[model samples]
Target chain A: MHSPHFSVIFSLDALTGALFLLTAIGVVATRQVLASLQLFIAQSLLLSLSALLLGIALGSPHLFAVAGITIATKTVLIPWLLRHTVSVEVYRTREIDRVLNIPSSLLIAAFLVVIAYAIANPLLGAVDLPFARINLPLGLAAMFLGVFTVVARREAVPQLLGLLALENGVFFAGVAIVPELPVIAELAAAVDVPVVALVVGLLTRQIHKRIGSTSVGRLAALRER
Target chain B: MELAAILLIPALASGFALLPTNRHFAAPMTVAATVVVFILASAVAVRTTHTGRVDALGQWLTCDGLGALILALVALVAMTAALFSWGYIRIRAGHSERRKEQHYYALYNLFVMSLLAVPILANVALMWVAIELTTLLSAFLVGFEDTPEALEAAWKYVVLTTLGAVLALLGFLILYWGSQVAGYAPFTWAGLVEAAPRMPPALLWPAFLLILVGFGTKVGLVPMHTWLPDAHSQAPASICALLSGVETTTVLYVILRLFPVVGGTPSLDARPWFVGFGLLSVAIATLLLIYVRDFKRMFAFSTVEHMGIILVAAGLGGAEAHLGAAYQMAGHAIAKSFCFFAAGAVATVFGTQEIAAIRGLVRFAPLTAVALTAGAFAITGAPPFAVFISEFLIFKAGIASGQYLTIALLATFVVIAFCAVMFHINRMTFSTPLGSVPATALPLSCSATLAVAAIPLVVIGIYVPPALQDLLHAAATAMGG
Candidate 1:
């Protein structure tokens, strides 16, 4: 499988991209809330890995900063915040009721990947970027899948996981697309991610305590008559 | 300095509120901070009216005419809402739950801080973060009631809006990439406009769509407005005032900032999309307002309708149109916040927000009834009200721009929404009482907020203050009119 043309870093990034897509699919397919959270941690890890690979390949310190921050926030801080905030009951609950069944959700998720590539294809053709070819479409696919996960999952933690996954999708694309951004923006973005989790996590705990469940998708009390 | 101080004051107030302080400390401190911010924002508005721009720190902190106008509106609402909270929240929390009140105030200040940050922060990426923070910060405020319903609303609010924000982040990143592709420029609104023409149309087109759909969700554009009603209805009146009033406006401000950037690229046109989505929102919201049973939810739907109208006005194109858009923005903030306050008062008096529950409020709660009636008249675009004038200006501007069809449709929806709102409010206010109720006196701060908010609601429609007129004119020009 070794080719003279493929830089090892590029090949590794492709592998990372593949694993990233897999983790997104895993998030959609998981039944246990804990599994979805675990998948999200893996996905965030994959995201930081890609950032590190891209940072090394592109020789950009900012991507490295992106890598460090994504790990600190998405992987470590978010889970800790959720563990502290969301009740153990939500994680222990199995067989989450989703809007769509897993098999159909996967089929639809597959369709979303095609759509993501179709959407990314034009932009790639429009301007030349070296790494965009690998990262852009895959990042977009993960993002679409993340959105799909959010739609399908009713559990608050998984839903929150879907949201963070969606963000991971954007940064996954961003790390390649704008590698040398002013680290100031990067730092601000870093702060933003944990707050999303903390806020959502705390809200989830409130819902669970008040309503005795975190199946947020099932909430229908506030609609018009 | 004012731009920086406007942000600094709120941040510090939120800090002070968050500290281990007495329960009563947060409300007045927040109110004091907002008063200072209002004065500063007005100073910036006046400065920009004369000078056209105020830059606190290059692109990172800048306020031009449009920014100042939004800043001023947010501050005005924040101050009134803080005042409203002092009385309303105390009543809602009861005397024993002092700590809950303190948390509410702390969250309230941070929420206000996020709204203020949007316009004044010129850097596009940082601006996106600020918009996201608005959702995160306010999520708990929406759930402050800690009811199952409030929790539902807060969850939906955070998850959906944050989803939209994540999507928009990619859009901003693409914009940053486009800027780099064009040659390095700071990722600021001004820099994006400067970089737009040189950017590949492919990049700009997708970025434009992503941001439009993404932030459009937060802006409560229909199909994406589901969470808005829930959050706005479920939140306390003070928070509702900010949520329905300036919070939505502040997010829409971000989407509107894209207009000039998208305008610079010759091959790209965001107008049709703007008008399309705007019309759709207005149409749907008008329909919802018709069947809306809950008064608070009714006001919330009206917010969606008003957002649509402003989006349509912005897309209608021309100086008059943009000016109308600016005017409508100001009018909606003032009137909508008033409507929410009145609704809150009615809800408190009657212990329900349902339209069917209250009848002949005038016979019983005359003061609350009168405030609700006035707010209703103001929001539904009654003659000599700011909404009517701004919407009128928009209609005339549409004719000038030759977008007769869009204007006609918008006019029709606006009228239907007006009738629907007035119809329900009319029944709530003047109709004969179905049941007898004891007379009630509203909290002092709530009454004071309504009276103070009413002044601008009445005066702006009748008289256009010269500096405000100049500021609106400058804002319209900044909007690419």
Candidate 2:
């Protein structure tokens, strides 16, 4: 009976790890800005599930509240507002100008994963928490991968989505290490995320309307004297 | 009582000013509100000399030596800027509308309230929110004219700074996490300071860098200062005064508040980084200021340069340098605003911001021309001005620290910037008229505002009060020099 329980716990941990890995991959592999947005939403949902499972296993009620707020804001309201504000029809039809090809981006991401592991391995080696040692590298890798996505994408919408992905990676790392943030701080962070989304959404619309495209390259017009 | 008067009155008056009243009433109402706040802030500064501190709002806001000094500076600039706005907007209203004028006043009050809240807020997160609110509330004001260029500058200002602020948020999270690891309960300023020694240095180091760079963007430090020239040049003169004077200083105050938490860590030496960035900013800004085309842009670049000076002073990390930094903040607040006010009056008289297009300003408006010339001299650190005194002290401290190259470079760049500003001001004031002269002179109110702005620049230059010097020493000591 004890062996079965241990197996169940091990499977849940593996599932959580796989979800993080796939989200990082999806963020890199996708070329379409709209697809990137959708992938970011999926990544947030997966993060919510992982946080919820960790909360249940640890029996921390505050974690449950955080999980719920994360799912509600990240998975639903922010994406819905972003979709409407960004004009999906424009992003859907146009192809994103990738700074690096998909294969090269994926390779770079893999290298980043190795470096993250190299950095995180010794640090987490002494940690006593279950799965803490393994998840640390994954969390850091996801963060690097998210930043890579931001650097690779040409369009503003995807760049923003990339930022959100990076935030998600950081959140995962926070949970994996600390287990739970103070409720007030968590709420502040959660509220700040959507406010940022709203501002970015508004600016994206304005940029598209004025410049006819949301490419950051066009923003180079304003330069120093 | 003084704390409540400094903070709460403007917040209350903000709501009242937003009400539907005669459009002409808004400006005077805002001015009255500012005067009250200014008096209370002065009282607090005076009282705190003897009492040592003032607490209010259930201790959520307190005015210590550092906070009191900044509060007094903000109140001083805000009041004069408010008076200037009254005349500035009244003239603008003749071209625009009463309703639009009311909106400007409302946003103006909101901006002041936000700046007033920053130094007083006791919680770190609450302070961040207040600082972010300054950006949001001021965005509309920055683009108040609604020209395409104005709107574009505002958009860039908000987007880039907000992005930097997100990094700051991550920094705050890291600090909170570090505190948690050290077994602290809540993320308050008092709590963090008490728990600082025990917190892990690894976490605190990254958090410090992130917050410095993050807030440094708003402070107009090099590489992140792209928004300063555009926003300051585009906005009206009153708004420019607030932007260059109080707003940027308020953000720097946040970074200074965090110095104690991370500066004490043995492995993480932040001074070199601050000095390095400071020297770089000064070099770039001085070079850029030499070639800048617009007078407003020139003044804006000077802000970047002065901010760099303050950072270098603070980074020197000693009693004397920290005192210099405190004094520099107050001096720059007065000098930069006076420069902007003169620039605004020049823009009004000459009907242009382009350097080449404006000439013979002294021939046309003598009072404004003298103000502009005086402002240029003061800002460039010429003799008998507060900026010159503080900047000299900074260089003295830098030399004492054995940063010989930094001192030499700073002196060279400051001279370059000085030449650039003098070049423009001389051409505008002394050169023959290139365009048609204005039919009417500057209004009494406009001249009065400029005079009010210039007095502090001249006064602090001649003498530094013992009480004010004591306050400066206290603030420097509190910042962990």
Candidate 3:
């Protein structure tokens, strides 16, 4: 009875990790702003699913709380905020402007995955958990990819989304390795993330209004004279 | 119960700020509430000194000597800022700015409430939450003016600091994992410190490094310090005082909290990293000072410089050095806030933050000119000033610890910074008046606020009160003295 449940949990965890990597790729590869936002929602949903599975497998109430938080904030609230930020015209037509083109960004992301695996290889042997071995590498890769997205993106909204993506990766790693992390911390992040989204959205809108563009490259006026 | 009041009053005051009645009474109420918080914070500090540590609310809120010291600093700075705001806001707020008054005070109170939470939190994760709260709360305050420059500064502050903060969360999570593996429950600082000696070096080193780089960003350590000048320069004068004087120290308190835990790990020293980052920040900031054009931006860089000094003192790793670090934290808090208050007065009267735009403050406002000059003198570590005493201790500690090279380099950078800061402020205060300076009188509240800030700088310089000395010693020991 336990073996079958364990097998199901293991497969679900693997699938979640794979989906995390896929959505991460989709976030960077998409050219349209709305499309990138949709990919982020997919990524967050996968992260929530992973959290839910971990909660069921471990029978921990706290993991279940975290799962609820990830879904409530990331999957539901943040995407809505991002969608509301862009008007219909900009939403439909805005190019997800990037410092690097899609093919190159994808290539670098794959390189980061290889680097993550390399870094995780030595750390893996020290841990006895079977699931962490798979989850940790995927989490690290996603983190690297998220940071890359932040650095490469020129527009404000994508940078915000990239930061959220990084948080998702961190959450994945935390759930995999330390499922018993106090519920308060997860709840704080859950509370804080939406507020951040609200502020960033507000700022992005203001930036658009004042400067007539959301491109960060145009904000070079405040530097030292 | 006092702790509950300490936290609740500011939050309540913030709520009050939005009410119509608060419009006429906001400044007075803010000052009154902050003074009450100051009294409560001193009581907690005294309790911690006598007992060594206090845990309340079922171990959720913890206060050690370190917490007490930082708490007192936050309270002290908050009070001064409130008093300063009394005049600063009155002068700055006009017809167009009337609607922003409520928003400003509300955010100010919430910001203070967040800083107050940091020292009291026992759980590392919760502490990170409090620190992140400070960043989020103040982002709006930083960009309060809503000008293009202010908005840009606010965006950089939120983005850079938030990124650094998230990295800190990752670091804490790793430590949580390590603590669990070592058979301790997660989240408690004491538990992690107790389990530190048994933890693997690989896990401990990465955790420590990640935390250093992470919190170091908020501390305005170089390379991650791009946001500090912008945020500080853009925020209101009183808010600038809080950010420069108290906020960085509060964040540094987080790094020092981890010292005893990470210092216990056998294979990791963690000192070299601190020293390297500390000296690098100091050297870089000093170089930038010579080229600084804005007085507020110059003071902002000075904050980065002082943070480096505190970090290096702590990083030197000796009883003397830890003690020096504690004193430095106190002295810099008092002195830096004084600089910001004075600089704010100068900017307001002269109607520009640019160093070149204003001259002969003495001719325009004799009293403020004198206050600004004294502040500059104290902040530059001039003799008989509070900062000089703390800096002397730090130098002595470095010599005792045989960090000869780092010490010599540190001294050179310190001297260069002194020269640059003095040169800039002297031109602004003592040189010929540049234009038809506005004849706005410095309000009595502003003068009183400057005196209140100045008294500590002089008093602490000449004599360390017995209670303050005891608080410093206990705080030093808490950091592995």
Q: Which candidate is the best by lDDT?
A: 1
Q: Is candidate 1 or candidate 3 better by TM-score?
A: 1
CAPRI accuracy category, model 1: high
Among the numbered candidates, top TM-score falls to 1
lDDT of 2 by residue, A136-196 (tens): 6676678778777766777777777777777787777666566666676677678767866
| Residue-level lDDT tens digits of model 1 in B1-481 | 8888888888888778877777778888888999999998999999988887888865468988999899999999999999999889998898898778878887888888889999988777888889999999998899988889988898889989999988888998898888899997878888888999999999999898899889999999988999999999999999999999998998888888899999997787888988999999999999999999999999999999999999998888788999999999999999999989889988888888889989998888888888888888888888889999999999998987788999899999999998998899899888989877754568888888888888888899999899999988988998998
Q: Candidate 2 on B97-185: residue-level lDDT in tens?
A: 87778778877888898899888877777777788778877887887776556666776677667656756766776677677778865
Give every prediction's interface RMSD. Answer: 0.7, 3.3, 1.3
lDDT of 1: 0.89
Better DockQ candidate (1, 2): 1
| Residue-level lDDT tens digits of model 3 in B1-481 | 6667788999999988888773667878989999999999998888888999887777778888989999999999999999998877866776456558878889999999999999988788888888999999998888877778888888888887887887788788878878877787547777888988877666677678778888898999998998899999998889999999999999999998888998888677878878889999999999999999999999999999989988889899888889999998998899989989998888877778899988887888888888888888888899899888888988998998788999999899999999999999889888988778766677677789998888898999999998899999999999998
lDDT of 3 by residue, A112-212 (tens): 99998987676666657676886788987888788787778777777788888888888888787888887778888898999888888888877777767
Candidate 1: segments with Cα more than 4 A from true spot: A1-6, B19-22, B438-440
The collision pairs in model 2 are none
Per model, kept true contacts as a fraction are: 0.99, 0.04, 0.37
Candidates' chain B TM-scores in the order shown: 0.98, 0.97, 0.98
